[model samples]
Target: MLDVLPIFSGDDRITRLFTLVPGSDFEADALSAIDALGGHTVPWSEACDGTYDLVVAASPKGDLSQLRGPHVLLPHGAGFNKSIPHEGSADSASGLDPAYLRRIGHDDTPIALHALAHPHQVARLAATDPPAARHAKVIGDLTLERVLTSAPLRDRYRASLGTGARKLLALVSTWGPESLIQQHPGLPAQLAAQLAHDEYQLALVVHPNERSLLGTYELTERLAPALDAGMILPDSHEEWASVLIAADALITDHGSAALYYCAAQDRPIVSVHRGGGELIPDSPMAVLLGRIPQLGRAEDVAETLRAYRPGAGHAAAQAAFAPPGDAVDRLRTEIYALLGLTPPAHDVAARPLPLPAPAMRVPAAFDVHVETTAAGFRITRHPAGKALPGHHLAVEHGAADEQLARSAGLLYRRPLPASAAPVDLAWTADGWTRHALSAYPGCRSAAALLPSGECLLRVRGHERMYAVQTEPRPERGQVVRIDPAVALSAVHARLLSPQPAPESRTMLNCLIGERTFRIVLRPATDTEATHVI
Candidate 1:
């Protein structure tokens, strides 16, 4: 009889049997636990036992070559487990493996075994409780549950979370001398006494490898006093959580620790990430980092901490923790079913609906009317809608270039980096070119420059009138007019045309409303103007 009570798979209600080969009682115990839970079992033999569908063998000298088939192996220990993956073709057992399961056989007959203690039994084998709550009861009675039960109540809860009167900021500090070195990289050796100061407590939890070097006098001077203040150098997750739960705000160098603390506490986190380090947009760390705002200064952190209020923040945090509808429960059920186990009949309760996706301010797409000649490149702009596509040109009457330049704002002229590909432009007075453009610089206009002068302006809606006063020397009124073929009104015709490449030798400045665009008029090259300016 095996004690399956220690390895109850959480959420995965699948039933499966397991056992270990002779001479490995330690592994046998683990396998017995697995088998007692309802997993299928097969005898390991020289000829390979056909009595069972899956044969598992555990031995230092076990011949795995004969045990070959589409089978999964539960190797004992991480080192041996990793070796199995590298050496044998068998899929080694791991908790995450979709096939480390209970159901088996071609006929799909359900294997019967002595029932395991329950899913929560896995905690007995763990050093510490896993962060994600195991029992529904623990989460069901949370304060979040109250707020989630009603819409108006939810709103009030969220608003309260955001209404902190003071922010209690905490900066996590490590103990090792290397940690001290990281914190104060520029401490002078000569003025050591003068520089000896303690502003905050340091919680020094250092890895064994870092303990030796931490005994330096200089490191002690820098770190000890802070610890005396209230700083903690905690090594374990529990310790870190305790500190974070009490502190109003958190600051950290990396994103993972910060995320765990923030999500658990619903505390506002300020990331003090390493300079020049950017979290990848698609990674889990990045997803977590998105929740916290980045604060550049310790003072800012102190200020925010001074105003933080726990109860108020709890509602917002609870709302954040709540899932969309009963999606989480549904998912939990599905995962268990897939693992070949009957899910428990946990009662579902009503909760507030998920908040809507955040509103984003997306700029309107642009239409470009372009033409090039011996003089320069010309372009116009208008909003994205097709209602009046070719009817709106930035340059109207006597004020095309200036109006376009002003509308373009900083988009008109940009210095190309030395490493970038060279640009080309062709200037012709007649048969001008037109193109639709997007991400035009200024709010409503395009950028353009004509032979008349340099400074830019804005072109009104659907009208061929440009407006702005760039140069003030002589009386070149703020706006001027250029060719109408490449005017803002001609945007539609340009967009409808097939894209062509610009000549390598032709480079010119393009003006779309007030923004200036540098277009390489490479006829034989892709005309997708890499926005330089």
Candidate 2:
């Protein structure tokens, strides 16, 4: 309905009424989704008897005959390929369900013109319900076109997702017992464990049906590991399309989202569970999956991800959509024709998808990975929930992960600015002069970075924590900033010798990944370590 909304541009020209056709579990989310778009909705129970020129709905649920008008039934999802229970008794091809179409009349005619995405669907309907097929027409796919047309705005979408430098690898799962999350609940967390947190951003793309069924609390619990590892979870259906455009690659199961990915774009893919799902035997989704590079749950996830290159054979899925680029104009014409009115404009087009604002969580604790480079220390981090081998653990004070805090090798609290992502424990710092190492008795060393980009460290036995800043103080904004958590990792490495801390006025080069900070270590004077920055 939003696609052809432009044709009915004048407010006084057409009175647009929206209502929920409640049936599936997903209807619970429909109201909020409509609210987000600022669309006024009438209660489905109350709006049932109202007469209208035409009713544009995506589903065949409820008594559509109540509208007292012609209808245009759009495919609710990327052209339905999965079989579903129909009318509570029998199994039927999802979109081409004969029972649903026959609900309108005795001769197998549907209440609305069955708008399909491809010719294959028309053929599928012809084979099953020939009477309904006669009313069906290929109107191309609006969602697919939106995903493809928004290609130029990938950078904007990626920026909104905060995916800097890292390629976004989305875990696209459809809803069902055979879905990826149901089959491999640990995959997202485990995959995040495999990839460097600094090098990649992992996202979990869940269908509305699945989200509605699992509930946020339960789904968050199941994918906690991945969430702990900083996996993104998008809230609305529109955001999913933007994420698809922004995504560099995908790790998917046999859902329509994956099929759409294959049709709309040629990005790299890693398929999970090749033999699962109640897919239509010769459906485009089934044919493509029977041959994509497979990722067994027991196999090394990182290796599988790196091995699956883009441009693998997905011809079957690519052929799923017909006349895709012309969906907007074609859709407008189709909708207006039902109203018996000429379209306002012949070349009506859809805009790029809205920017995605994913639910992002910053992991406070990390198993800090360090290497002694010639310049100084090179640091990388993994979420402490599932640390890799040989990682030196660092947990912030009062972190949600208590076990990590107790077992951490280095613990510190730094005074952080607003809108900052903590490195070590930069988010918490009450004071500096009154600060004592005894506060973190479980760790060997405690450290902090001041608001002015100064590094401070306190060895366990030291009377005063050292104030380490570059001489003449560092300049106000350098491209590669320092995280006290990362700086402390380098400092910990330097203090491993008899010198438990950097000597006064001694210049040291500290490197954390691409960021290099030059600092002067000094034992804080009585007046210097007495006040907080």
Candidate 3:
């Protein structure tokens, strides 16, 4: 079952008959009009048993909670003339409120105008004073009960109307010749004119502005030869609906008439660019509708309209704008998984190896890498990478013959800070040494120094340590290779001794992974080696 909840306000009986109505114009008159048609006085009672499987409302004032069923029609207005009457059991003025009209004219009440539903007599109305036909719906903002009239065979009426005349009608404004050009700089003028012409015939109905002859003149002059002349312009809402209900397409500019007409009738549409090339981001038309195609050039307008014909290829065309395959395929896969089915094998790759962990903890120091295991714990003492949470920092060395096993672990409460630097490490083979740099604030720190005779220095030297600073480089998940010889030359390092003596000598500036360590060459003099090394 299809559920539709349309809001309208014009005739009170339609509201009283349905579950919900969006209010529209001529509130008091609309109620009287519906009262005159239904003949039966409806009492204030909530009907919610699906007595009617479908609820059709034309005004916005009717409450939808009263009916539990499918709804059709949006209780909105498309400037339908409710003050005028049509030659039928329904009277226009009676269906609308005179007081409401006065309030609206006086700006005391802001109300929307709706079109009346009557698709059968559109062609006849157009042949006469089309504006005089009152075939449109009206919805007032203040009351929904004013316009709801019980139309006994609305479904049958729709079905029958679908087979007659044109399938859709679009109303648009034509202000200037450059309007189309400004919107679509790439389009040609002649093509746009033809598309507009084709939209009228292929669509069930069309209502061009009577005040402006530029659009009509252009259509009759340049596009008339190639078009079917059966398409006629109607001036009234009655004629608009008669064509709209049966139309395959509705093409128009961004006018309120086009906006509410397509919305109220549930018609597919094409909106031409009317003003500046750009559309307002928060415009009402964009918010309430979709599937609107653009028609800028004269030659393509007609073809664009023909493409949206009800049975021609709307589904495919619409799919071109919004594809429908991804969600369905995803659902199918999920359903199979729920059914305990082995999913079909596809090309999938293996995961990559993880990086090392932080050698030690330091507050406000991020980018510490570390990895702990039962066999042993490995820590990368660098401040330039990430480490997993819950890594073991301290390890218990194995007994005389047993293998080493990690016993304790620490999970970090937050991510490590990147602002801290790794200065040095002091250690024996047993476990992690005291690693230090600048203070890590409330965290442990230890700085390994060069031998006493050699001296500890910054990137520059001990003399310039207070002023030494490094430049930032772009390195994300990467390793850069460098040669010691070239690096020494770049930093202008001076050798302390021609070739270091044994035991006390080593390349103190070499950085391996995260920890900085040196390769010992030979021992220093007895006196020098005694105190360091």
lDDT of 2: 0.69
The lDDT of each candidate is: 0.32, 0.69, 0.30
List the lowest-lDDT window of 10 residues for candidate 3.
141-150
Q: How should the candidates be ordered by lDDT, best one leading?
A: 2, 1, 3
Please provide, for model 1 over 207-313, each residue's C-alpha lDDT reduced to its tens digit, 9 standing for 90 to 100.
Answer: 22233334334444655434322233443322333344444456554323343344445665544444322232323333443445555543354454444444433
Predicted structure with the largest TM-score when compared to the true one: 2
Evaluated against the true structure, the overall lDDT of model 3 is 0.30
Can you write out model 3's per-residue Cα lDDT over 442-492, one digit (the tens) per residue?
222111122221311222112211111112223455333322211221122
TM-scores, in order shown? 0.27, 0.80, 0.25
Q: Is candidate 1 or candidate 2 better by lDDT?
A: 2
TM-score of 3: 0.25
Q: Which ten residues in a row have the lowest lDDT in candidate 1?
A: 190-199
Candidate 2 runs further than 4 Å off: 1-11, 35-38, 85-92, 105-112, 313-317, 345-348, 358-360, 371-380, 388-391, 397-407, 412-436, 450-454, 458-484, 497-532
Instruction: List, in order, the clash count of every candidate structure.
Output: 99, 2, 111
Residue 497 CA displacement from its true place in model 3, Å? 99
